[model samples]
Target: MSRRDAEDLEAAPDLIAEGARVLSGADIEGARFEAKIILAHILATKPSRVVINADPLAPDSISRFRELVSKRASRVPLQYVIGTHDFMGLMLACRPGVFVPRPETEVLVETVLGSLRPGRDRPTVADVGCGSGAIAVAIAHHLPGAAVHAVDISADAVRLTAENARRLGLAQSVRVYEGHLLDPLLAAGVADELDAIVANLPYIPSGEIDGLAPEISKHEPREALDGGPDGLMYFRKLVSQIEALPPRRRLVALEVGLGQARQVARLLQSGLECSAIEMRRDHGGIERIVLGFIDSQSH
Candidate 1:
């Protein structure tokens, strides 16, 4: 075949079509879009430009693209493969063994941001179990005067979160520590100073972790899921810790799994003696975010 004919066979559309077919066979949704995105990554070009530029992949590039497609076909999370995830309009570094930020958690962030008191400027906030620094960085980025801390049990997650904060020029604004839940903050004596605390803890029931999507059960970190028997184990633990806070009006936001919001809210209300609680639904209409406010007088 002529070189031009070879180019036609190796064009972006042809590659994406072939990839999409393979991905679809693997039961991946949005196969075409994923294929395009993978191709765009290999080509170091935008997805729209993949075809607009109509450039054929180099032989080595083709091999690399196929390798990534195979990894995805095996159910590896796309964010891990791409090395980044979009959260709150910011691209955060992601890696295997770290929790990927979900779109639903954006609602949790919005609620926290909105719930901030009018005159309480420069509030200190802690993002417990802050995987990839999504919540911590988003809060710091949006609320400039706020002090943010991101903590995680996994060293990999801590590193990724710190990297993201630095990459987004929030290294100074968002402090990251390696510890389980809020332990690091407590050690640093920042626990009582925290005006707000947000956590997207592992809420998937232990028995249900293996039943989740292959991308989650097989690829994502188990510590980032697996919430013991009733899926409220970590929430209970965090609430217990919050009880040590000094008397003050504090805002706490938590992202819970399916059908787990109400239980988590109750845990907050009773455990923290929260004066009021609010549940916010995600795009799916599931009550995914539970916010609790403990008034100073409640102490």
Candidate 2:
């Protein structure tokens, strides 16, 4: 082994302590926690075990752990560094190009699931802009009878969604497609037959994107974050598209930014011909989800 690697292995505790100090200096919250997580990732063990064992690392593991700590210290998101995230009680694989699923978005999934009638068999649903397939896979996992079609504009997102579905054993139930919102569903011949449509589309205003944390503004995909000047660009387009399509009985659930729920609810009511609309809040009391329903026979 190289001289530096040999030295690092011998002083593993000192090395971990130093890594945590560096992260703390960079203002990274939970610096020690992140340090252990990075070390455990390299050691192929749990973070809890890492703390309890106090074992020295191998030369290679020390070197790799140092590299990851440095990356995290630079404000790289921990999820991206670890290459995974948890959403709706499901572990999802994440990558740089795809948007990481946030905890608030889970409310959107729950809203959609709650709207489903109990004991319904094989209800058809569509997920628009299905980044990382978090919502799509979670819906299919929780509602085994759901036939879910997930579509995304980015090929990377499409592939990631498919991968998550396959890993979660939802491949048979969730189909991932590459295209703009709703287009893939139309092509797949399920546009008019859908019982529900859910989307967590880009809702951050273009002007406000620059103010987001570096982990988001610099690392997350812009196409997944920018919602135009007023933060409703994609929502407006989606509502217009639904307006032009033939009417059908469908429940629509969308995740909107804070203070955007009322505006989005209005748009859905007028454009989608929804007869009833409801707003659901996240644990933070922020209105995060809007649900609209249209009767099967109503225009």
Candidate 3:
């Protein structure tokens, strides 16, 4: 078969099958299923609807679809290839190098939404290390009265988060800044007024990063995944930062890796960072979410 032969398949089923065959080499877990998803993206419809239509695709459309498949076959992430990821019901733009938000983190968002209590009519939230502003925008979208500040160290992350905020009509509610953790908020003169700091910082131990799927280890940003030698590097810094800051009812919510929740919980409770800590499990039954409330005066 010619290199371009698969692109010439006119019938939808034949075209999708050929695309699936191509995907099996590198991106294969379920190539046919993914092929249908690619079709859904091209048609701007649901995957289930891809086959029901079964309409003959135009040559240009087929070529475009196959090109996307080829990118996926090269082991590019599906979300990156599609250039969007559905997070908390919002389709946020995605790109190479920027870490993709996981669905499991939605439970972390829910944990924050249910637990955030600042005793004020309006609240301030800082989504530290906000990659694409997933948590920040979702919180601002749900809490129209909130002011969410999304801060990240990476310029690409900051730009992508800002773009997602603007696309979701949350530019006013969700502000994006390029800096590490809460420093941007402090510089913006609102650090002292913050009610919550939520983060899903890198927690994969250095030794384990290369062991992750190629889709993650090879394609995603390493700084967004590496957590130093022990995977507690960034978390420890964040806890210390909060502890050193002036005290208030500043809530902290974090997403932890498997088997690391207990140690992180201990880290939070060991100091003045968190007065009381709580853990919540994700759909995968992993202890994935942790939250803590800061005692106003350590009473």
Candidate 4:
């Protein structure tokens, strides 16, 4: 019998653990969970159940598990294989082409909530380039009273964001619009009225995208990752548009690439400067968030 066939005779739990050990040694975090998920899928059982029973997997299940291990070993992002990721403590539905929401983006949400907290009133918020609706849905869930608007340049992103909003029960409050940057909201004449505008826009330069990890370079959409030349294309456009708005009590937050915080902050001209900009550090101590607020002087 093949190795897969042998597994059908109640493959030993220790054997599965062996596979997990190999993957772990290869620097794959959550090895057991990965192993369990693949095994469970092949067995047609829940991952949780796979843990409780410790039952040997069948031949087909073992074969499938090995294939997943090979893929994971190739440095494929775990989220891509699992088809979902936990962001802001929520399970967001993810897909191959959609930009995978990074954990550091949570700072953008927190910054918005912190600023809005003092007012203690419902505010209209916009998440430009709302890939996967991670930022928009998280805000809506955190502040149930807020009206959230999300827009993405990519149609695929718009569809994914809409689906995620619906899945998270924030569809009513989080409106997903398909358009570039602020176009959708401006078309609706709601740009100037926003209390907060947040985004995790593409900051990777067009040429640099090819150097990104395969999980991003090979799998994610170019329009969602490429930020044109110098990686400041979108920021320049966003800053210019935001500055034109008649000064209102508006806060703008963006997730910037490494070492781009200072440059991004500088783009906030029209009296908006670093003082008005708050820098947030990510888990890796990189300056990740550039938050600027509209003040009376800017008007």
TM-scores of the models, in the order given: 0.94, 0.93, 0.92, 0.86
Local error of candidate 1 at residue 206 (angstroms): 0.3
Model 3 clash pairs?
none
Backbone clash count, each prediction separately: 0, 0, 0, 0
Candidate 1 residues 1-299, lDDT tens each? 67866775566347788889989999999998998888888777777877833655566677788899988999998888777788989988888989999999899999888888476678899999988889999999998989998899989888988999899999888999999788899899888888899999999899988888999999999999989998889998998888876788888899999998888888888888888899999999999999998898763
Candidate 3 regions exceeding 4 Å error are: 1-13, 117-121
Superior by lDDT: candidate 3 or candidate 4: 3
Off by over 4 Å in 4: 1-9, 12-53, 58-64, 71-75, 270-275, 296-299
Q: Model 2: per-residue lDDT, tens digit, 138-239?
A: 999988888999999999999999999999999999998999888878887888888888999999999999898888999999999999999999999988
Give residue 42's error in model 3 in angstroms: 1.3
Off by over 4 Å in 2: 1-8, 14-16
The candidates, ranked best first by TM-score, are 1, 2, 3, 4
Which tens-of-lDDT digit does each residue in 51-77 have in candidate 3? 743576666767788899999988889
Residue 47's C-alpha lDDT in candidate 1?
78
Candidate structures ordered by lDDT, highest first: 2, 1, 3, 4
lDDT per residue, candidate 4, 1-299, as tens digits?
67656656554445457658867977777887777776665566667777634555565555666777777667666666667777889889887778888878887788778888788478999999998989999999999899999999888889998999899888899988898889899999888788888988888888899887766777778888878888889998888788777777678888999899988887864435423667899889999988887764563
TM-score of predicted model 3? 0.92
